[model samples]
Target: MQLAVLGSPIGQALSPVLHRAAFQALGLDWTYHAIDCTPDRLASFLGELDDTWAGLSLTMPLKQSVVPLLDRASDTVVRTGAANTIVVSDGQLIGENTDLYGMTQALSDAGVTTACGVTVLGAGATACTALAAAHELGCDRATVIARNAGRARQFLGPAAERIGVKVRITPWTTAPAHLEAELVISALPPGAADELAPLWKPAAGTLMDVLYRPWPTPLAQAAATAGRRVIGGLPMLVHQAARQVELQTKCPRPPYEDMLTAASAAVHQLDTTT
Candidate 1:
């Protein structure tokens, strides 16, 4: 069966590598590819596909746009209004959001305690996922910082209401305060995050940078130097992709180690290519 990940700037995605490795380990005959599809061209892109496509992984601008195109979706997808995984069954498209599962699992695996505070950077779709994840992780108080305050407030309002977390929205120019929370999740893009490093520091708890590429982002490096625990975005990426594989292939559990190794190798290859 054929499966693929779709996004505008999708060439950098490690999904194909991880999914291919899982398929190989499970002895499943499946091929996965990444396609660069922007929001304007998404309709035409979907029109070209047929039933032979087993599944699709949506990213960036398409995550929200693809929702209307799906025949059905899980409750979480409806709640989040976004989809990262699309399962094709008998020509029907079923959308699901595995990003929350991935982010939640990563926080749990990192031993982040319940009822803690969380500070998240960015107000995009991934940041929304992080907000949901923080709530699921038992974070009662959360703050979302974005380059644009209006956009941040808009994206965070519904999620904060649904999750019942005290959500605060602020401009990215304001430095994040080290409050009572023990975890800080950087959900910003790589370039933007690099610029924000000088203004932020992880105090007493773990700092999770949601960028896997470039290995350790500047924020992570700064946090590490400040004697704070650090978690990379790779764990979330692997876990989320694993959940997608399970949903698409009906596998009981994902081959985690194999996927991680493959993702690492793929990143290494990318580094060499550049």
Candidate 2:
């Protein structure tokens, strides 16, 4: 069996590491790879593939673009208006969103029992998933801070409306001061987090960064230094990949320790390559 994570500039993806580890631990002869697929090339790529492709992990530009190309999608995919995982059965592609699963799992693992006010940075695809996660956690009020305020609203406004959560969009510079919340989720890219680090005050709540590649992100480090609980994005990646493996192979749960070891090794290899 074969599977792959498809995205543009996918060199940094850890999917292969986790999936391969799970397959190896389970003694399955499955292969997982990453394809650097741009949006313009997606259709031709999908058309070229046959039933040999067991599943696919979509990221970035492909997530929203591939939704219309899928034969069908789960309710979660429809609601999120994005596709992260696709399973092919009988030559038909079915789309699902494991991003939400990842976000929710990360929050739960951090012991965020009840959703309080949330300030989320970035309003891209990942931010949409974060909003969905916040709603699932019962967060009624949310403030979305984005470089492009309109884009942030475009990304999160509909989902917030559907989920009955009050969401407001604001420029990152004008984000409210003296903010109080039980949880703060940073969806910004790695470098962006560094700039936002100073603006971040040490709230007595959990601070979660969706970027895990660099390990302790600047925001996470600041939060840690301030004695705040922080959750890295690696746990979310692992848990979400576990759900994807279960969906694809009906495995109980991906062997997390093995997956983590493989992922850590992959990260080290990535560091060396860079």
Candidate 3:
């Protein structure tokens, strides 16, 4: 079977590396690659797929954009308005979000099992998943800091409600006020929140920056320097890709450690080469 991670500016995507390591460890002769696909080309790309394709992983702009193009979507997709995984089951295209699961697992590995209040940065599709993960971690209230309130509320409002969390969306200026939350997730893309790094307050809560390529993002660096626990996006990326492998291959035991090794190596290679 074949699978690929799809998105524009997919240069930094490591889903293929993670999934390839997963399939290899599972002893499956499956192939996973990365494709440069944009929102406008998503439909055409799906239309061109053959039975050889088993699953797809989406990133960035393609996550929310591909929702309307799926034959069916999971409840998480319905509520969150985003999905990063698509499984070609039988003859139907099924959309699912493994990000929430990924985040919880990633946090658990970092010794965070419960959070009461959370502050999320950059309310995008990944922020929706961050909210869901917070919910799973026993959080009932969240504060979202985003540059665009409309887009943030559009996706986060219903997702929080359905996931049973009360979320308040605020402008980026109010971000520092909520730095004391039990867990703060920087769902922003790399470098997007660099300006706010200088404003990062020393707090007791953990900070999870959802960008792995450059290791310590400015925000992450500030948080760490301030004595806050920090988690990079690599572990979350591996966990989510492992879930996608399970969904696509029906493999009960996906080798997450192997995938982590491969993903870490790939990230290091990209970081050094470019």
Candidate 4:
């Protein structure tokens, strides 16, 4: 079987390593690759896939873009309006948003069981997943910090209402006072939150930065220096990809530890090379 991760600038993705490790451990002769696909050309790309294609792991611009093209979507995808995992079963496409579980499991692994006040950085599709994860972790209210207040509110307001999390949208230029929360999930890209990192003065709790390629992101470093519990995105990536493996291969249980080891090694290698 064949599987792949689809996104622009997808060369840096560790998904192939993780999934290949899972297949090796499970004795499955499957191949996975990374493909550069954008929103405009996604339809053409999907049309070219043959029966050997088992699944596609989406990232960045393709997550929301692939939603309308799927035959069916999961509740998480419907709730977040994003699809990260597409399984091809009997030539039918099924979309699922495993990112909800991904973020929540990453938080739980970092010693966060439940949270009250939450602050999420940015207001993109990943931010939506963060909000859903926070709600699942018992966060009743949240404050989203973004640059475009209008766009942020327009996208997050209804999502907050749907998820039952009272949300307060704050502009990035404003002070970072609203950042004081039990948990802060940074959905922004690397170096995007550097300005707020030094100014962040949260009294306590964890900060899970959803970026692992660069090792200690500026935001993550600042949070750690401030004595906050810090966790990277690798844990979440591993868990979500493991779920995708199960969904694609019909494996009741994939080799999670093997994937984790492979992902850790890949990240370590990247850190060393950089």
Candidate 5:
């Protein structure tokens, strides 16, 4: 069977490597690749797939765009209006969000089982998932720090409401003040929060930045120096892709450790100390 991860700038995606490793570990001959796909081309691209395709992992703009094209959407996808994993069942497309699961699992693996206070940085699609993940981790409310609070409220409000999680919109400039929350999830793009690194002095919070390629992001590094728990995005990426592998192949356990090892090796090529 075949699988792929789709996004506009997909060259940096580790989904192919992660999922391919999962396939190998499960002893299944599968092909997974990265496809540069924009929102405009998603529908047609999904339409052109043959029966040989099993599933797909999505990144960035494609996550929300692919929701409308799905024959069925999981509850998380329906609530957040985003689907990062798609399962091809009997030629039907079923949308599922392993990102929320991956985030919760990542936090759990880092010894954070629950968070009373949670703060999310940036209000993009990933931020939506972060909010839901925070809720899953026992957080009833979350603070969304975005460059534009208005845009953040507009995009993230309904999702929060549907998830029954209250969210407060705050300007991104105030991000440094909210780092003391039980959990701080940085949903900003790679390098978007680099300038904030100098100002980051997290107070007793676990920092989870959702950018793995350039591991130990500037903000995360600063938090770690302060003796705070810091988690890179690789764990979440591996767990999410592992769930994708399970959904695609029907295997109960998809060898997540293998996936992590593969992803770590791939990122090590660029940054050795991940």
Candidate 6:
């Protein structure tokens, strides 16, 4: 069978390393690869897949875009309006979102139990998952920061309701002087949160920056400097991919250490070069 992660500028993705390791460990004769799939090209690419194609991991621009292409989506997808995993079964494409689980696992691993208030930076597809994850972590209220207030409000409105969290919107440029949430989730792309890093001061809690590459992102570094517990996105990425593997292969318990080891090696290689 075949599986791959699809995204733009996907060459740097460590998904291949992780998946290949998992397949080898499980003795599965499966092949995993990465394909540069831009938003405009996703449809053409989907059309060419055959039975051998098992599943796909969508990233960035394609997460929300792939919604319409699916025969059906999981509850997470319906609520978040985004999907990261698509399983091709019997000529039907089924969409799902393992991100929420991944995010929850990451936060739990970082020692976050129950959050009364959650603050999320950036209002994109991933931010939707962040909101859902916050709710899963027992957060009653969520404050989302986005450049465009109208767009943020519209998108986060239903998502917040579905997650059972009261919603509040904040302009990106006018972030509050004191962000005192029990947990702060930075869902912005690489480097996007750097400039605002200094402005963030949490009375207590952890900071999770959803960007793993380049090792210490400025935001993460700043958070660390402030003596806050910091979690990078790699653990979340690994966990989510493991869920995808379980779904596609029907292996309830896929060996995850192999994947984490592979991912760590790739991160080490990147670290040495930088």
- Counting clashing residue pairs in each candidate, in order, gives 0, 0, 0, 0, 0, 0
TM-score of 5: 0.96
Candidate 6 lDDT: 0.86
Question: Relative to the true structure, how large is the alpha-carbon lDDT of every model?
Answer: 0.83, 0.82, 0.88, 0.88, 0.88, 0.86
lDDT of 6 by residue, 1-274 (tens): 9999999889788889888888898899999999999989998898888999999999878998999988889999998999999999998889999999888888888788678878899898899999999888777788888878899988888878876788888887666643556678998888888887786664557888888887689888878877778899999999998898899898899777889889999999988887
Tell me the tens digit of each residue's lDDT in model 5 across 1-274: 8888899898778888888888888888888889999999999999998899998889988888899999999999988878999999888999999998898889899999888999999988889999898888888999999999998888899989987789999998888788788888999988899887877563677899988867678888888987679988989988888888878899998899999998888888857543
Steric clash pairs (candidate 2): none
Using lDDT as the yardstick, the better of models 5 and 6 is: 5
> What are the TM-scores, per candidate, against the unseen true structure?
0.93, 0.94, 0.96, 0.96, 0.96, 0.95
Candidate 1 lDDT, tens digit per residue, 96-202?
A: 99998888888778886563778888887787787777878777778887789897777678867765678888777664464225777887887777765665443
Better by lDDT, candidate 6 or 3: 3
* Residue lDDT tens for model 2, 1-274: 8999999899888999899999999899999999999999998988877878888999887988998999999888877788899888889889999988888877787788677788887888788778788888888888888889887677678877876678888887865452345778888887886865666565587888988878788878877776678898888888888878878877886687888788778888877788
Q: How high is the lDDT of residue 82 in model 3?
A: 90
Better of 2 and 6 by lDDT: 6
Candidate 6: residue pairs that collide? none
Could you tell me the TM-score of candidate 3?
0.96
The positional error of residue 182 in candidate 5, measured at the CA in angstroms, is 1.4
Model 6 TM-score relative to the real fold: 0.95
Alpha-carbon RMSD to native, per candidate: 1.8, 1.7, 1.3, 1.3, 1.8, 1.5
Pairs clashing within candidate 3: none
Candidate 1, residue 220: how far the Cα is off, in Å: 0.4
Better of 4 and 6 by lDDT: 4
Model 6, position 197, has a per-residue lDDT of 73
